[model samples]
Target: MSGQGPMRVLAAMSGGVDSAVAAARLRDAGHDVTGVHLALSAKPATMREGARGCCSVEDSRDARRCADVLDIPFYVWDLAARFREDVVEPFVAEYAAGRTPNPCLRCNEKIKFSAVLERARALGFDAVGTGHYARLSGSATGPTRPVLRRAADPDKDQSYVLGVLRPDQLDGALFPLGDTPKAEVRAEAAARGLVVAEKPDSHDICFIPSGDTRGFLAERIDEAPGEMVDPSGAVVGHHRGVHDFTVGQRHGLGIRRPAPDGRPRYVLGLEPVSRTVRVGPVEDLDVTTLSGADPVWLVDPPSGPLDCVVQVRAHGGTAGATVRVTADGVDVALAEPLRGVAPGQAAVFYRPDGGGDVVLGSATIAATA
Candidate 1:
C-alpha cells in the first residue's frame, strides 16, 4: 500500500451529476483518470421521442461536457450490441420462462463488470471506476483483495445493485465518491462549474424508457391468453400471458369478482408449462426458508451455517436468518415469515457490522418454503 503509483483508472460516465462528480473526485485524488460513456441506445428519429434515461444520448453529451470540464480524456464506446444481448435479450427470455428477472443485476454482471472491465484491462488500464454509490477499500494485502463497502450516502447507496461484483472485478474497481454524500458531490460539481451538477438522477430502467414492461414484452414475445386459477385448481380468470404477472401483483388481474372471504386475491405463482397464473389469499405470499443456485460470495465462504441478515429485494428490510452455504449457494431460513419472496429476484446477505460490505453476494431467489 506504500507508494504505489497513481492508479490508471477508467471512469464510466453516465452523463449524470453522480458520475461526473465521481470522475472529478478521482482526478482530484491524483489518479490518472479517463472517462468513457457507454453508448447503450441507438439514435432516435426525433429529439422529443428520444431515449433520455441514464444511457440516453443527452446524458452521453452531458458526460462529454463533464469530461471536458475535468480536462480528462473521454471516449464513447458502443456497447449497444452487447447490451441488447446481455441485458435486453435475457430480460425477454426470463419473462418467456415465466420468471421475473432483475435486468439491473444482469447489467452490472454482464455489462459493467464483464464487458466494460474486460475492455479496460485489454486497454492496459489498472482499474475501472463508476459513479455507483458504493465504496471499495483495498484489502489488508492490498488491491488484490479489495473489500466492497456501502456508500456514505445511505439514500443513494447502490450496494444492493452491485452486490454481485466478484473479487477480481472488485480488485480493479474504484468508487471515488463512495465516502462522500450525494448533495456534497453536486455542490462540488456546481462549484467547479460542471454542466451535470444539477441534473436529476435517472430512476427508470434505462433500456425501457417508456417503463412499460408489459407492452414491451408483448411486442418482443408472442402472447397467448392463459388461464388464471385459484389455489384450489378452479379456473377464476384469464391472463394475456403468464409472463405478465408477478408474485405479489394485484392490478390488471382482470378478475372482476372479489374473493368469497372479501379479502383480495394476489398472484401466488406462475406455472409456465400450464401457462396459468395462480391467485390466492395474501397469506399465501408468506414464506420462511429460501434456497437458490449460483451464489456469489464476496468474502471467504462461510465455514459453517452462519447467522446473517438476508435481503430479498433492494431496499427490503433485512431479516434475521441462519445461512447454510454449500458449493453452489446458500440456503436461508428466515427467523420470521416474509412476503413477496419471488423467484429470480436477488437475495443479498449482509454482515451485522453496518460497514455495508456485502459479505455474501446476491442471488436470484430460486424457491421459498
Candidate 2:
C-alpha cells in the first residue's frame, strides 16, 4: 500500500457487493476515491425489467446508492456506443466465424482498462480500482514493475481475463478484492450496510441479458443451412448454421444418428466457407501443440523458449507447456495433450513457479496441432 497516500482513485462500481466494498476500502485507505458506474447498454428502461445484467439501469442505481452510503461522489458514464463497437459486435462476429469469444476479456482489454483508464488519467485520477479478484505486486516507484497474480480465493481468481492488460496499464491499476476472499467481501458489505451484500453475481454476458448467446447471434447474422459431416467427409446430418456449433461441442448438435461405435460424436472443427460442421470422436479434440496470434505480454517477451503453464479458457485448468515467442504470436507445446483447444479463445501464459500463480501474459489461440 506504499505510494497510495491520498492519491485520487476512480473505483468502477458494478453495483455488486465486491465493488461496493472495494470503493469503501479505497476511501478508508485515505485515497480520494470516486465511484463510477459504466452504462454500457442502450436498452430502453422498459426492456430492462428484471435487470439481472451488469449494464442494467437498476445496477447503476445500486452503484449510486453504494457511493452515497460511502459519502463519495458518483457518476454514470455512458459507454454504450463504444461497448457495442468494441465488445458486442466483435463477440457476435467471432461466434459467427465459428470461434468462441470471451466478451469479458474484450471488455477488459478494450473498454475497461483502455477506454476507462485513459479517461480516468485525463480526469486527474492517479489510478483506477476494480473489484476484480487478482493481485498485483511491486510498485510504480520500485525498480521492478508490478505483476499480476492470482487472487487468494482460487475460485474467484480473475487473472486469466486480465492477462490482456499491458504493463503500463498494470502500473495504474488497483484490484481491491485481490487479497480478500469473496465471503469476506460480502461480510464487509453487510457490515457497511450495503444492500448489494446478498446480490447474486451476474454470470452471463451483459449484452446478452437472457443468457441466450446463440439466439443473440442468430438475430445478428443471417442463417445459412449447412451440412454436418463426419471426419471422413461423409454427411451425417444437417445444421441450421455453422455458428450453432463450437469445437468440442457434443450435446445440442441435433444429430439423430450416433457413431457406428455406438458412442457420442463431438464437434472437431468448423468450415465457414463450405458451411460444414465436422464431428468426430472425443479423442480428436486433444492437441499437444498450439499456436496463437496477436500476443500481448504483460512483461517483456522472452528471447528463447520459456517453460510455462497455459490456460485456454476462463475457469479452466492449466496445462504445462513450452512457449516460444514468434513474430506474430507464440507457439505452445503442451507437456500433456489438452482437449478442446479452440481458436479465438485466449491462451493465457502463467509462470510455472509458485504453483503457476503469476500471470506472464496472453495470446489469442490461432491453431492447434
Candidate 2 structure lDDT: 0.87
Best by lDDT: 2
Instruction: Write the residue-wise lDDT of candidate 2 on 1-369 in tens digits.
Output: 246467899999988888899999999999999999998888724233353456777788889999999999999999999999999899888878888888899999998898999999999998888999999876544566888999999999999999988888788888888999999999999999999998888887888778777888889899989999998888999988888878999898998988899989999998888899989899999999989988888778899998999999889857999999988788999999899888889999999989899999999998888
Worst 10 residues of 2 by lDDT: 44-53
lDDT for each residue of candidate 1 in 1-369, tens digit (9 for 90 to 100): 113457778999988888888888778888899999998766521221233346766777888998999999999999999999999899898888878788888898899888998999999887788888887777322645666766788888888888877877777777777888888988998999998777887776787777678888899888868899898888888888888888888788999878888888899888888888999998899899988778888777778887777777766656878888766677888988888778888888787566535546666778777
lDDT of each: 0.80, 0.87
TM agreement with the true structure for every prediction: 0.93, 0.96
| Residue 132 alpha-carbon offset, candidate 1, angstroms | 0.6
For candidate 1, the per-residue lDDT at 77 reads 96
Question: Candidate 2, after superposition: displacement of residue 10 in Å?
Answer: 0.5
Q: What is the lDDT of residue 169 in candidate 2?
A: 79
TM-score winner: 2
Residue 193's lDDT within candidate 2 is 93
- Clashing residue pairs found in predicted model 2: none
